[model samples]
Target: MKIDWVIVGAGFAGATLAERIATHLDKKVLVVEKRDHIGGNAYDEYDESGILVHRYGPHIFHTNLKHVWDYLSRFTRWRPYYHRVLAVVDGKKVPVPFNLNSLYALFPPGQAARLEEALIDEYGFGARVPILKLRESEKKDLRFLADYIYEKIFYGYTLKQWGLKPEELDPSVTGRVPVYISRDDRYFQDKYQAIPEHGYNQLFRRMLAHPNINVLLNTDYREIENEVKFSRMVYTGPIDAFFDYVYGKLPYRSLRFEFATLDREWFQDVGTVNYPNEFDFTRITEFKHLTGQEYSGTSIMREYPYADGDPYYPIPCPENEALYKQYRLLAEKESNITFVGRLAQYRYYNMDQVVDVALKTAEEILRGI
Candidate 1:
């Protein structure tokens, strides 16, 4: 039997679109996933120790988009979670974003105040800017902050995380680290920030529960896509694989996660910590903090960065981009298929962004349906 839609990859892209299209457009969708479960890279579950752990490192739901938050809230309740990050620096645990609180906490009160004045004088008051982004700021004025941040927090950590020199990477990468004048140490300042009350798996389970949606796990698209016919297909898997890499392998960076359970009640004060100064691994996350799980024992994950793994991130290289552009042109030429999601688009988007894309994808598909 021919289905109205065939959605590949049960991650946020395929799952969100499948449910939305099936319900709103009255179309039947069959979502096939290579993985056994749903929710994609942001998938979370309670471990054997009863701590909710992210299967693929840490993922926080924080977005300025109110509509994305509202759309997700329909499926699950949220726990008000303000993600705070601590960076290990100079044999001390300092809060990241290099805020006023972190500064005062790290140095003498008088010196901290003086340095704050110097910074504000250079960047202007309430600047809310990354040091690198300040065009007219004097080099001498930035020398202290930039050198200190680069050495203590950014350099080694970035090297291990992405396997690239900080200088070689995009300036926007460094722009993410802001030197704040306020005591707000929270990592994200998004208007809406929260974690799912029952975890993301349940949210996905509810989203894809429509009768018009069929799910097939551990199914290879190449093996079965030709056998089953459909009106149209939405693929969220890697675009390179779809066309059998007719151009060349598009660049992607992947991660490796090692997790363990501890007999202790707690491990860290916060959800995430960046150990830039100490270890080969960039960060070690305690699961209970992120999941809001109340349990005696705790679970932690150690992340190791490799040259390549499962292509968690698309390397923002020029050559790969040109190749993806060629594939995109080919996809346009093909006409019957729509490619969405991080792997397909070769973008580095978090959960909310993927959801937004999926919602838009559904709307476009329904417009034609």
Candidate 2:
């Protein structure tokens, strides 16, 4: 069969590129996914208890990019959602990013008030400061507050999540959850933050609904590359795997998720509760709070980070990035093949960021075509 493009992986990168190519460029594209389903890690479905649960984990869609928001708006309607996360530190659950409100939540009012003034004085009232950067403060009170946040809030979590200390991993990893001086308890202050109205699965279906696009699920692209005729290839799988691990495998941290259904209306006060110091699992995510599903029973997932599993997080460090650069060099050598997405790029990317990269990749292809 004649195909204009053969896209590997039915995730955001492949699916978005395929949609753009098929709809805008009117090109015949075939999407090959190794998994039995579409939507990749963002895939969500109803459990036996009839509650919508993210099969991989809770993926809260939040982005500051207006173009990314407007592009995704084409396929699915959105349910306005602002994600909030509470971290268990010293037996008290406080807002993560350890904001000004989080200070009041954990400390005595007098001490908290003093620290707040010091924080605002040092870094302004609305500033978001990285815990490590805050730790560099020369002031005694500020230094104590920074150390308290690091030891209590960040250190243990980073150790468990990446199997590395706060200092070892790339600053970007720790920078993700910054200490906000503002009263904003919301995890992300992004301009657009919402989940698909139906689900991510439905969104993928709508995206790949075009006549020019076809999806082959549970099939590796290598199994049928010879069976079809395609001009160019868009690979969204692991970049190292694409070149058959020529330089060696790049390190990654993976998560093992355990889901449970409770008879109660809710499990946690918020959508997610993070255990920074207490448990083997990092956090527990309640699906009902995220999806806004009114069910008598609630479904929650416990995330356990491990060495072996489906690659979830690209381990951010100088060594890993150096290894990834080798594969990136090889990818650049190939003219007809385009590599995109988190795994392919070996970078930590949010859902909208992945979509934005896919759109750009598609645009590049269209310009050449």
Which of the numbered candidates is closest to the native, going by highest TM-score? 2
Give the per-residue lDDT digits (tens) of candidate 1, residues 21-90. 8899888889989888898887888788767888998888999988889999999999889898898887
After TM-score superposition, the amount by which residue 312's alpha carbon in candidate 2 deviates from its true location, in angstroms, is 1.0
- lDDT at position 143, candidate 2: 96
Tell me each candidate's TM-score: 0.95, 0.99
Clashes of 2: 0
Candidates' C-alpha lDDT: 0.82, 0.92
- Tell me the spans in candidate 1 whose CA falls farther than 4 Å from its real position: 124-126, 134-136
lDDT of 2 by residue, 1-369 (tens): 888899999999999999999998888999999999999999999899998899888988999999999998998999999999999988889998799999899889999999999999999989989988999999999999999999998988999999999999899989999999999989999988999999999999999999999999999898997899999889999999999999999888898999999999988999999998988999999999999999898999999999887898999899999999999999999998999999999989989889999988878877987
Q: Distance (Å) between predicted and true CA of 60, model 1? A: 1.3
Q: Give the C-alpha lDDT of model 2.
A: 0.92
lDDT of 2 at 166: 95
In candidate 2, which residue ranges exceed 4 Å CA deviation?
none
Against the true structure, candidate 1 reaches a TM-score of: 0.95
